[model samples]
Target: MHGHGNVPGMDAASEVGVDVRWSETLRTYHAVSNELEHELQAGHGLGLSDFELLKALCRCCAPDKGTVLMKDLEAEMYLSQSAFSRTVTRLEKAGFVERAACGFDRRSNFLAITDAGSERYLSAAETHRAVLDKHFG
Candidate 1:
């Protein structure tokens, strides 16, 4: 009765344990993400989210093709709709990404990584992996 409303089998101690673990997980996520963001921005002028977007596009496309549908990219990103759109616009302006109409659906757009974008992503990916290796490996 002193803790969060009880589930059938769960107790206050269990609730506290869950909360502590969740808090730690969040803290770790933030720390790792921030470090990666700083490394990417300092080394490549790309933010973590920007690098992630480029990586997603590259993963979705073949070596000869570097395009992903806007919807698909949205599904891959953790950002809100408005934030994703803004990120895309920012990358486009930076010449790292390009948006084009989907041939099958004029209402839909496809995002493609440019040569510059691919190079940036590839370089930043090394830093990203190194950071992860340092922390999690």
Candidate 2:
């Protein structure tokens, strides 16, 4: 009786494909995330989140001359503003980022990545690329 007792309720079979795809996607994302985190930690003593922020900064058009605004990062990364703010604060404390008032917008603060931060990011990125190539390619 136990073997057949747990049939999923109405339309369950039809929806199973959607559930499977979502689960698979999550699994793949987790695997990639774990690899990235491990590589960053070993290569730069930085967390995956820190590496992401640095990458965003390095990708900025005016990295050396100005800060990347919080709103821009939030939009680009799809992070909540408060989450971005907390991560920025962590980077700032680690000497990987600096905050300054925007020249054009007093209400906006720009986050700039430091030289050390850039170097660390490059190293971790190299490691991450290697891992992906080895596993996925």
- Top-scoring candidate (lDDT): 1
**For residues 56-126, what per-residue lDDT tens digits would candidate 1 score against the true structure?**
88888767777878888899888898989999999999999999988888989988888898888888899
Candidate 1 wrongly placed segments (more than 4 Å): 1-10
* Per-residue error (Å), model 2, residue 127: 1.3
Q: How much is the lDDT of residue 18 in candidate 1? A: 90
Alpha carbon lDDT of each predicted model: 0.88, 0.77
lDDT of candidate model 2 versus the reference: 0.77
lDDT of 1: 0.88
- Assess candidate 2 and give its TM-score to the true structure: 0.78
Per-candidate TM equals 0.88, 0.78
Clashes by residue pair, model 2: none
